[model samples]
Target: MSTVIAFIVIFGALVFFHELGHLIFAKRAGILCREFAIGFGPKIFSYKKDETVYTIRLLPIGGFVRMAGEDPEMVELKPGYRVGLLFDENDKVNKIILNHKDKYPDALIIEVEAADIEHRLFIKGYVDGDEEVLKNFSISPKAVMVENGVETQLAPYDRQFASKTVGQRTLAIFAGPMMNFLLAIVVFIIIALFQGMPSNAPILGQLTPDGAALEAGLKEGDVVYTIEGAEISSWADIVEIIQKNPGKDIEFLVDRGGNTLEIPVTPEVQEIEGRKIGLIGVYSPVEKSPLKAFVYGFKETYMWTKEIIAAVGKLITGQFTIDALAGPVGIYESTSIVAESGFWYLMRWAAVLSINLGIMNLLPIPALDGGRLMFFALEAVRGKPVDRNKEGLVHFIGFALLMLLMLVVTWNDIQRFFL
Candidate 1:
């Protein structure tokens, strides 16, 4: 149960930070973001704040920000179409009623001749069903239109994703993945600050209570020089020697305050990953430098980023099969395993996952941020935008393929872990 809660909190934080990046940059770019949603399908919870509705949906697969002008106009006003318009005190049309005109009895009924909601912001039509009486009414810049009993504010040309400069749009799309990387770095820094920077030195910091090391008189600050006549210069050396001789007595030559001491201890045998390993249960020394903590954060994040990139490169090169990929189920299983280790281990896992997510999202696969970036690059080269219909179709196909892939990966995970 604790592991489940940890997984949910970690996953939720990752999604929230990713979407928040898009929201921040989109607002700065003057785009009208109608909804900032987490997950897909039916809404489980939602709240409206300012210009955007924040929502959490049923599926926990992914999230998105719905920006205006990304889709076609919902309601179109054509010549000879009848509509009802409500006006503000300034005599500008504040609302256009597409349906349920009877609910707004005081609205002026008009047979639309022409309308330009984006740029000109005006409607010219015959008012009160009189064909001879032509009237032109200005629409408020913040005017809202009702369709099927729902009111949605109209998005002007300036407040749209497409209307922004290419640079702004690119940043808006890139920010989501960038924020994931930032989350990783921040989490790493937090871990470093709290736990100190991990060191590989063979010096002992703490010994497990009642464990072989503690029971055999091993003390903190004792630097192990050799184990059973074998040289130990690093923690890896100690681990290798100890793990190789489970349940066997080992001689430890240590330097405590420049005084040599020999301690004999029998390692407790423990099974890990289907193999028995010896455990003296001692922790390596840590560096408590505040500056080092910050440095470790960035260095750790960069290291994970490089490792993930290499793994992805291997995948593309066919060195690894699709079976290597893990979906939500696999992640949950990993989370459970890591959570059993300790809090710090779980945190480290989350940071690595965040970095992996950031790098994966940057892959130039359709329906991903990298895919949008690829389109933007082409637009810049061609000196014009791609045809909307063609681009939309490409994205639609890409999204379908991605969903199919996700389903396959999820099934594989379920079979591997459960069946």
Candidate 2:
């Protein structure tokens, strides 16, 4: 039950924020948004307001925004009307700009009153006398017609998407991922302010056999009062003292079971990631106050984000194994363990996971919000949108690869748990 609740809370918040991005940007772009729906498949419940239908679906996994003119088949156009045309769906009238074209057969006398701009559904008006007509369009009922013995149905909604200006459409695509990134930063800051942070303890908890602490005669439960004549309040202080005293003997004032004692110990040299630092084996006890908890929470959030990004980079560079990856089952089991630990631990983990979710969603992969933003950026740079069919195909390939990876990760999780 605890695991279920945690999953629901975490997934729900992450997904809601992601979709909320789309909803916000759609409204900002003055697009006719038909629906802002959370989750997928059949709607469980919904409400309509201000020309937008808000819905909760059965599956709590994903969401979408339905915008006007998003489909090409739906764009309606009238005959003999072409240049600088904008489709006004609300008005349902096509404005015609009459232009003459001299290239025509004498018998046909096809005066190009308006050129049917192939491959473009919408066009912008300029200062020139280039008149354009607006048309109504819809996408449905796929059928084929023969042009010069080649059968093709009107490529549905292909031209409609091409009509919008690069800047306007790029904003629509970028809004969602940008929102996720901002949410992560905000959550990290909040957690930093509220969560109990891990700090070093002044006293050594366990002295490993042959470790620096043991070699220095540091005993368990010995409260380190001073190092090198500097008063020690926390384990961090001890670390600072040792780090500065590498390969040097240090004087210590310790309180062991109410008895004060002074001892001299040589700091051991320890190499971490190719850098040598002084080491004294000790572990900090978890401590929390209301003020410290908040600060720790936010710090932990930021740290976790950095850790995940680093881990992903390592994985991509072959420094990490795919076996380290976790799927839904792994998360479920981990959440259960955290929930059982205690309230503060659970809260800390949740905050960390929230920040992780925010970062992961921002990765530029197809079938993800970030991936869509990449295409939008390209369109913005190239002065044109990508072919809708090609874009859809790329996303479809990404989705398939994601599914395969999920399956592998899920299998690994099951093996770790039940096996």
Candidate 3:
């Protein structure tokens, strides 16, 4: 696959899954998610529903879920949206007035004259306000079109994020990372059981009839211990060496009944699909049970999460350095290589990346999910939220520093991978 295509899919899926988590939790907690955008910067395409603007932006590396009153700078705490219009089964003008009286309890109803409102439906709210959503807002079938200017009112306070309890707010913040973790587990489950994972032992499950293995004196059920003096842990290691050295002499170390034997064999040079490749003529067994796959998938995600936490701990203790980090460029290059390997390989790598993203977001660093959770935890103890300006200043500084670090790491990755 083209590196660009690989980069887009990998980045898009990971980021979309992460943002979806926050959006779902926010809606559940009665917080208005104003926008759910994939990527950053200028939006290329967008659609609005339930007061949320879903969009795909220009950048492909990251995404965001914009909630009302969550970011004090971007959104108004009492921003109002025209959700639904009042309509009546009654046909006359008095019916419309009665409909407004019965349905629009909080809205300021206004009548406007229009040039073309015969049999057509249109509901106009605030068309001049800077933040008013005016396009595609009406859902009524029989409501007459209001072409003239109309006044709108503020939305209910209960619908804004700032009005929610601290616990609910914390859940919405944490949900983004939690969704990433769930994505990893689901991806792993499908790949591990259905696509089948590489056998750790790489034991030969069966031999071909008079094929390369039979001619080379290799028997079935042979446990491949090493190849070319390198200890073998999985079938992937064996395939890597074989594919690279087609028709070349291979030294295999196998354990048969506690006896170590060195077997020399030459892989068959096979020409297919305009490429010269090596064929070992043996198949490895695979795990195919759904229940077992689920169990192992969870275990794999847990282990990966633990590894990430350990890496972070090491970095904190000066045992690890910034050089170990992989920026966007590094991820793109790695994804390209994995994509070339096969579908299963890419799936496994994506799962690992998802788990890594989830774990990273949970770190108690400023401007991250865990950082907000830290403040929330403090609020729970102190019985009051921190000062908004102070918290915003800290996050602003942290975001700046993070962007700087990203630039440095991206430069390093460009030097290592591209240049």
Candidate 4:
């Protein structure tokens, strides 16, 4: 379905850039990342590169960059940690296992009889546990083949998230959200350059038949100057005025066919979801310019970010409700609608959604980038890191609450949109 494709592309772009940001910064900070994943659930594809496994999963709702020491449950393997090596060939027996006997005295070396030098290699961590792995490596079998609550190997002390200074860890945590902003900026800039900046003058172009504009004696060639005494400079100005006043009468000063005339028009009030909004049938013309495009792109991104932050503030202060929020369902449905509006509109919506993702990740709740930064702030004040277990527990609780909230929001979206 077109909806499926649009949702995947939109969510994929935003999340990929976000995770990539963390991956780059983590590597730069000398932290070892085990996995760079683009989705959740069962992995559809995976491969090892350098020291990390890159994975693509079936779900598109989320993704993650798994850095060493970030998770408290993962423990670094000590030098004394032992493993069992099983191989089918005898020529490379000690060369692969007993050669390291000087380092690991208690390691088990099992020689299985098989034809040729094509040996099945396995380094079993906690052979007392079940997860026996068989691999076909030419030499080393030190891969983390563990099972039964095995203590896995984490990054070196210098490479762990906690081992690093507060500043380093803070940067890594904040990098994810910052990347989202960067993506929005890029998307906006490209769209502006390709499609051009929106017209500065408030000129009406498309007029819907039997709509509010037609009922008010307005024609397609009219250029609006002022609406309800507010100076209308562009299309944004028109929507801003209408949104603030639903079912309200407005005086429009327009230049129609070279004659200035005042036309009275009232916006039609409509109930969207749970909110009352106003709408008038009209469209604006887009103008192309290289210089103005860049400026407009930056300005638009800033404006969208500011508006999202304000909306979040309002939500926190009880000025807004959860009904006003769009969860996965609403987003998927909107993705379908936006996809139908052509490539430019789709890109524009992607930019807006990317900005929203960036803002949401900056919220100071547990299990989020902002939450980790909160811990960093406490460390700055205390001159040392907080108790690792306590911090982890707080994030666990926060994650649970967030999941519950998502369930509720998703249910609401389904009921509102699909049902």
TM-scores for every predicted model: 0.89, 0.60, 0.67, 0.70
lDDT of each: 0.91, 0.64, 0.73, 0.75
Q: What is the C-alpha RMSD of each candidate to the true structure, in Å?
A: 3.1, 12.2, 11.0, 8.9
- lDDT against true structure, model 4: 0.75
Best by lDDT: 1
Worst 10 residues of 1 by lDDT: 281-290
Error of 3 at 411 (Å): 0.8
Residue 346's lDDT in candidate 2: 64
Candidate 4 wrongly placed segments (more than 4 Å) = 72-154, 202-282
Query: Residue-wise lDDT of candidate 2 within 1-419, one digit each (tens)?
Result: 76798777776776677777777766665565667888888999998886678899997766788775555422233443332221234531133222231221121121133222234333232222333543233222222222233323333233233445666666666666556555655554454445424457787765768767787777877888998889999887887888877788898899988999988888789888987788766655445466665555456556777898998899889999879888878888888888887765665566666566666666789977667778888977887777889998999899999889989999999999989
Tens digits of lDDT, candidate 3, 319-387? 988888899989988988888888788888888999888888888878989888998999899999899
Give candidate 1's TM-score: 0.89
Cα error of candidate 1 at position 366, Å: 0.6
Steric clash pairs (candidate 4): none
Candidate 2, residue 389: the lDDT equals 92
Off by over 4 Å in 1: 200-202, 208-212, 224-260, 265-280
